[model samples]
Target: MKNVLHYKGYSAKPEYSAEDQVFYGKILGIDDLVDFYTENAKELEQEFHAAVDDYLAFCQEVGKQPQKEFSGTFNVRISPELHRKAFRKAQEDGIALNKVVENALTEYLSPAWHENRTVILPEEMAKMYSAEEQTVDTAPDDASHLALWKRNWTVVNGRTEMKKRC
Candidate 1:
């Protein structure tokens, strides 16, 4: 079950108030503290949507721009040793430290970053298997479809081992 609600490009992490018997949430990733609450679980989503609409309407009335979830600028802390190493690397590459960090983040977030991960696309599978054997109808990018493979990999004594989960 999802603990967060999303509406109009905004999200909120809601909590249940056992004492008050209401589901309440505050707008996330924004400077303003916008909140919503509903006594009925079925109306929780409607309340969240109404809150977002009201917030947007109010911003428009006041001529104030609504805040986006992410601003693309955030501070990250690192160890002195790691910082020095990154600085030297950035200097050697003739780029700013920010660019170096951005490149590292990009590479880390890339789908192929997991070396042991094995994802066979439809076209790739066609080369090895017969058409009759191809039963995967969902897109390869669908995480739920990929999870159905039930293949697990773990490092065992410095060696990667692939095992099937029961």
Candidate 2:
């Protein structure tokens, strides 16, 4: 019989059996463990591949950027109730509670306005934009697309007019 590992704050000890490890390790895409001891190695590989593809698709849809490594942190104290709320929210959001608190504090301290707008195009639209046949002179009929182009064009024209006056 394998020993169980107790996760902090949880009453139940998680079974550390080879079968349990195989299941979780496959879910986490740890191929080495799955291949070494799992009987359903082929199925685990397929599942891992599918998960990676799904994650990639989700990242593309959501415009997720590569995570950057953070090197420093500052400590702050909060009320127990607030801490508990944050912890609950973090669990619901599938993020670390510390990250949730940091994000909240960062947003609170930062100004609402941003210097640049990051645009993410759908795969088809991105392909269209990258194609040499598409020219800036061609206007798109979509209202939101037209609005963005008009806004930037207006800014450039305004800058040019200001330059002429000066």
Candidate 3:
């Protein structure tokens, strides 16, 4: 004889007949499945109920909901040594190796590497001082003069008393 069980709109048929049991129970490792069912049936059932409760509570809290569905895939590649190290770390932290990788990449690619600059010059300087424009021999070599001028301007601006003396 066979029995069918239904949960969450899905049905599972388990054969317990002598001939079918020989195939499912002996050959296909269904005996272990039965042992697991017998040993942890109540706990597993409780876990399912708790999951359903949590899902219902979440739906209520959010107000609007869609039929639950599985979505998305993530993929990555790494050196074998790095993969092994990440796997070990994930095991220690009780999280998926993918999560560790995601966190690492997120942090590495963050805007922390960016910096604000005080001054940016227009591109005309390069065209204006082409090699043909060498009349002064040392009219303060290359755009270094611009930086020097900025520094001198700051010094002159800071000396208000010296400006009055002048």
Candidate 4:
């Protein structure tokens, strides 16, 4: 079963509060924090729509714009070590660091694409597969697909490891 309810392109992650006997969620990936809860499935749906409407109404009343959950651009600060690594990767891939990070985040968040049955294909895999291989029955699984990413190896502490950073 689907866990989230979507409204106006915003999605709320579903969780159960056992102690409170209710289903609750936080609208994710937005600047503003919005919390919603309800005791039953029927009420939960209504509450979800109400929460979104109220948030928009509140923003209108306050003369502020409501934020979309994702805007395709955001800042993230990483360590100096990662900074050096990502720069090197960008150079090797012949792409910008921003594109590298964007691709990585897209791959990492593939599961979150379920709402529209969408997918984020890795660069190598997208090229590796034939059009026929794109079928659901022929598609690769998580474990095997992950192995493809591990092909290029490096020695870290005298052991072989894959570079997972973007």
In terms of TM-score, the best-performing candidate is: 1
Native-structure RMSD, model 1: 10.3
**lDDT tens digits, residue span 1-166, model 4:** 5577888877887788899999988777567888889888678877878888888899999998788555668788878998999999899989999999888889768874323222455556455454532222222245454443223333332333333312
- What's the TM-score of every candidate structure? 0.59, 0.24, 0.25, 0.53
Best by lDDT: 1
lDDT (10s digit) by residue, model 2, range 1-166:
3222222211111222574655323223222222122346455434445544555556579897323334567676778987888888889989997788778779757764223333344555455444333323323355564444332211121121111100
Ranking by lDDT: 1, 4, 2, 3
Model 2, residue pairs in steric clash:
none
lDDT of candidate 4 vs native? 0.68
Model 1: colliding residue pairs = none
Determine which window of 10 residues in candidate 2 has minimal summed lDDT: 157-166
Question: For residue 84, what is the lDDT in candidate 3?
Answer: 91
**100: Cα error in model 3, Å:** 0.5
lDDT of 2: 0.43
- Residue 134 C-alpha lDDT in model 4: 28
* Count of steric clashes across candidates, in order: 0, 0, 0, 0
What is the per-residue lDDT of model 1 for residues 31-136, given as tens digits with 9 covering 90 to 100? 8999999999888888989999999999999999898656679998878998999999889989999998889899879975655554434554345544333322
Candidate 3 scores a C-alpha RMSD against the true structure in Å of 26.3
